[model samples]
Target: MRPETKEITTESLGVLETAALLRELTAGLIASSDFDAALAQLARTSRDAIPGVSWCGVTVLRAGEPASVATSDVHRSDLDRLQYGADGPAMTAIRQREMILAEDLRRETRWPRWTRRALALGVHGVLSAPVDIDDQVIGSINLYSGRPGVLTASRQLTAMLLAEHAGLLLAAVRDRARQSELAGELDETLAGGEVIGQAIGVIMTQRRCSAQDALQVLRSASAALSLPLREVSERLVGSAARPRG
Candidate 1:
């Protein structure tokens, strides 16, 4: 049988108010240039706009390590340390790539190390969601509360929505990094085009073809084989050095 679940409804804000808040949050995120600044803004927004959440923070998985990126609470440093040590609810959610909640950390046994430490720090309840990039889990968003059962079904759904947005922002950052690498590679390739040109010349002579025709042959071969132009040029050069069979 399926586990029982609770339904939570929010009556504090009407549809229009919620829409305005989401617009403002998205605008702030777009205005920020870096992940740190955007996360800081999101933390603050969650604290002010969302109800029953005492602390809001983002944890990023870097090089297979979980680290707290930003938070609205002063104890973020401690939390970061806990997560880095792999002894926190945030890390657990990241490892499992699913939502995790502890209604009362003092009594939970699933994560003994995190539970003991969090209870000592006066964290009674916790909610965490994994941040995903193209279905690959990358990080997490953690919300902590001093009261038990603070993250109801409604609050968890809201947090999931926020986490989804955060995932998009992170994906953009990843895309930019990839684009930068590609740009650098293109610059290097253009700089080394002379070698490719020499290979093309060799092809034109050996194949008895015009210059444009040789270039098209090279391009077509590169596309058909799904190889880089540089690799194709190198192969062509190597073939020219081989003795006739």
Candidate 2:
């Protein structure tokens, strides 16, 4: 038989335990290897962690465009529509860098198109929190529920905390990836430097020219060919190493 699992709810856990739960959830979000994976896990973990969150997802913003990155619901295209259409609480939260709420879509007058679609889908309420990194808004974490009044004061506080944790985790993940990319670039640069040095040595010996003159020749060739300095140097090195035939 399958093991009976119990829901870990805020009501069941005391203050200290709740803190630990939040930490564990935060750690889980950070444990992902990449930002994409982190966001995907965050959707599921936050839905499980935040009370009264029927659906949870992330909206990644770029160049003032909102894109649905991850979602807990199977029919998550709801978020995609809201993003592409550019009218939803998530977009509002991202713009304002604050929480946005639509307590009742049926009675909502702020966004008629969104309210109609949301009502049709049985999503009566929506709570969105801005995901910020270094005080800069990058996106939003959104929750949709069937109930009209979902995010009470206590829930809002918890959702904000979760959004902050997710934002920090994503930032760390992106930073790590950027560091790795820079490291790889450095390695390539060093290798290119070595090859360029070899090519310069070849030119100096063949033409009895100075190192500076040889480098100038290589640079001219690179400029004329519209190729990178590294590529030109690499080709020169290869030509010198080729067996006479």
Best candidate, lDDT: 2
Residue 88 displacement (Å), model 2: 0.7
The lDDT per prediction is 0.71, 0.74
Candidate 1 wrongly placed segments (more than 4 Å) = 1-21, 64-68, 82-85, 134-137, 173-245
Best by TM-score: 2
- Collision pairs in model 2: none
C-alpha-based local distance difference test score of model 2 = 0.74
RMSD in Å for all candidates: 9.8, 8.4
Candidate 2 per-residue lDDT, tens place, 130-221, comes to 88754333888888887887755556767777787777888887778778866864665477888888888989999999998997888788
